[model samples]
Target: MTPDQATPLLDRVNLPSDLKGFSDTELRQIADELRHETISTVAETGGHLGAGLGVVELTVALHAVFNTPRDRLIWDVSHQCYPHKILTGRRPRAKTLRKGGGLSGFTKRSESPYDPFGAAHSSTSISAALGFAVARDLGASPEHGLGDVIAVIGDGAISAGMAYEGLNNAGHLKKRMIVILNDNEMSIAPPTGAMSSYLSRLYAGAPFQEFKAAAKGAVSLLPEPFQEGARRAKELVKSVTVGGTLFEELGFSYIGPIDGHDMEQLLNVLRTVKARADGPVLIHAITRKGKGYAPAEQAKDKGHATAKFDPATGEQKKAPSNAPSYTRVFADYLIREAEADPLITAVTAAMPSGTGLNLFAERFPDRTFDVGIAEQHGVTFCAGMAAGGLKPFCALYSTFLQRGYDQVVHDVAIQRLPVRFAIDRAGLVGADGPTHAGSFDIAFLANLPDFVVMAAADEAELAHMVATAASIDDRPSAFRFPRGEGVGVEMPERGTPLEIGKGRIVREGSRVAILSFGARLSECLRAAENLAARGITPTIADARFAKPLDQNLIRDLATNHEALITIEEGAVGGFGSHVAQFLSDEGLLDTGLKFRSMVFPDTFIDHDSPASMYAAAAMNAPDIEAKVLKVLDIASLAAERRA
Candidate 1:
């Protein structure tokens, strides 16, 4: 079953338990085939291709040498788990990766027994592996084997503070675990900081080659009595020779910067380390991202994620859309704002293209800042810029913005710095699923004191929100918008800052009032039209600010209309919760006023189209119409009983 053997061993393997029977040579052949399969699958699916390809040999070597389901192999971020998934009974599902109702892009515990822990967020693998290790020690008896725990993390993930915290704890506890540092000198963007430089030196030195040569030479001359002593001497000699001083200081026995793509090298090193290592160990493997695909290898971003592409030429097909995306709209607006206002600055946490800040960066290079995957730093950096009298727009995805919540509360909100947070992907992101969905930002940002939160109903409103954020120089403010294209409404040539708490009436009607929040306004309007045909005319209002609640308009709507329905594209404790609280506080509920909040449900929503997800959550047109009917029934019953 060696990687070179043409037996299709990979196709036969349905589980990690299946690999237990294969010889080391056979395992090597499977690794090669696995790499081929991973490359082909990613070409079709268009996902985190490079990271997975780089770890194919390492993944195969790990499963072959270790009992996976029992041993617990945790991958950081799980972007590199395609090969791991292929080897662990999920090869057939690989083609459907990231699609609706298909295989997950990242590792998931529920998806397979071999995936003991799930991960989509970065810098969590080491801590998760350590937890498993500690649990195994406490749960297992002396007779039962408490299997090995391994965490394969990237060099980029190490830059996060959580990884260091895990490493520090593991070192102090002297846990029996292995931490594989897969150094490819990239993480979406190029690696940064002093740590990245140190790793570069280690890779350049090729310390593994020198250490192996010295150990073989010494072992050849050792007598029988001194053989045990000689082996210990060899480990000491190797440890010192490899410049593992940093890891050794942290209480980990560090091993090689071995070639990660080399199947034999990876297997041999992994086997040697697995058998001989005591306490915590760090095995550094150097790999090239997009190893097999030359086009991806040469691309600036390594073809990190693409649309459906040609496997032969690696050329991505253009997706047809009726209107420009909200991201592009924001990017164009920001550039225009920067052109007029010299104080305007842009910042992103390693996602220039995703947040649409790349255009701003190109147009105004000095004004743009990419702080790597360090969201906390990016927030504070923006705060600092604000303090210096610069209007800094911190462009970040809503889910990733969660990482900087504390900073938002402490640095920006508390001090009342005017840092404009342009929250992109602020609702149910299509394919990225729960970990990437921007469902909680509304609630989180609204709760923070001195923070003004706004949600855009359309691209035109988004332009206005941007202008509003820029004009407000006295306090911290944020505006959130969805992932895809805006509704085909004509945008204003220049934006005018709207009053903070004021909302506008889109359509005036009599029986029921629908107070819409954010991009969900369009759906509310559609529902209103549907209700109109049924002789139930509804009032539609776009409540721009989620925080302020438009108290005047809401109270008027509650008093005048038969029923009030609030709608937003966020989770339970967001806009809906705030409206519920407001109604309760205002004593409107005591008067037996009918009310219902339409929002994303309590459970985590999966990867699907925006329309499908809204329908699933009962936030679509039909669902809204049904809710209106129910409310009207309640009102009718109350009126009849009163009469």
Candidate 2:
């Protein structure tokens, strides 16, 4: 930061306490060095690059002004916490980010005292921070000495329903907390909804150079009911600070549209709030997503996420692709379906690119809707579309779909609307770990009445499932696919709809049958080859449908094979449990047929390669091979004893 100086300011700082010793100018220098360090760190270990870069000065200001760990600072989604993590004594391990047994990409309470609350999902920070504020007053942990509670939420995150709930509750309670609205005008995608438009209007006029003028300008934007109260609050602030009309209407001491990049402004504003704030405060800071880094700033997503890249050139280093990803395959197939049906439409909750719906949006802009991080609303909106006789595919990550479970059950499943759920990232997603891993969707969705749940075993099967879901007109249907590339299998030009509740046998064998669901079909095939080495030839079948499962096929497998094994890339109460329940009901297990269900263990697996994660869960190829042998060996031992 100080070019001529021999020593860098960041080298002296190991923790937030070290920042307290520095002068304002030195703190600014530290912020600059911190930004540089962040860029360098993420270059080595790619992660959420833009957010941390955007909040470098703010991260410094928060840590310098607030007594974090003692004073809780919760980051909404915590993707922006990279700079915060570096300052909080985690700089040494920064390179280990998002790896197995390494630092998490998001905040974790277990990781550090500074990270008082953990978050990977969005919009929960305000509520969590508010809870901390209330707990601080209640003296919940007297030993920790909680001082202040601050929540830094993005413009996109603040648009969600839960944030509004937190705002409403906080407004009523009027606690001494702070909510810093980081108005970057970009999230993983561009910010949407009325709130985004409102924020854009707040800073677009360039009237915010003077605080009083900004206050006067910001007030006129409020609704009639809110405007009078906003004017009173603006009058109350008396030229020292500005009133944010919407936040003020919610009874927060709205503060700024200040330059988040400005070290002086951030420090002054934060320090002023810390010294004198009595009620809830909202500081509006307008910043860029990829503030300092040129490559990130120029990129479409503002470099929200990336692979390891060159620090100098910002060119990413990626392995050569052997096949198209499941996401891309789904998007391509969905486009084909859309071409055939005029009523076919798509929806995603702020993750167009992630769900591969960005491609669909490009093809049919009118048919694709992005509901902006509000999964609950998105689900119901799709249901409404379905009710209006339009075929709507609600494409959401398996993890994100959990947020809309209640709506899915009520609006879609109860009414039996023909809403197609295209579930992406439906297994142990690597890097992002358990928080984002889609483990419960199969169990949760399959449990509902008349709900058709399918898991694609490969890219081609995924294409077929998309067509199958589109054809199912009377009831709701969902199909899940994993992250990453398909197994380089030959793909069909277009999808031919498969029969509901039926499965197909890939190979014929005797003594044992391995019935696989989802992407684990490939692993079953791999295990079969290994089993063949020992003269234990096992049959392999792909169970396409989880819910209305092919009972005839299950009965046949039980009747023929000495042992049957069910495997899926999901939690315990999913496909395996359903199959087991059916077998027990039919008295198939009563006839002494040995059976095993290989699934993810009861615990949450940490961030790792999917291979490592499955290995830990004992659901890999070797695990499958081991389970078959264990079941057959037990039968062999029983026979030996009988002899």
Clashing pairs in 2: none
Tell me the number of clashing residue pairs for each predicted model: 7, 0
Cα RMSD (angstroms) for every candidate in the order listed:
4.8, 4.6
Off by over 4 Å in 1: 1-7, 20-25, 140-144, 204-245, 590-592, 634-643
lDDT of each residue in 504-588, candidate 1, tens digit only: 8999998789998999889888888867776878999999998777889888888888788998888878887888898899998
List candidate 2 stretches off by more than 4 Å: 1-7, 211-243, 634-643
Residue 288 Cα positional deviation in candidate 1, in Å, after optimal superposition? 1.6
Q: For residues 78-165, could you state the per-residue lDDT of candidate 2 as single tens digits?
A: 9999999999999999999988889999999889999989999999999998899999889898988859999999999999999999
RMSD of model 1 against the true structure: 4.8
Rate residue 348 of model 1 by lDDT: 91
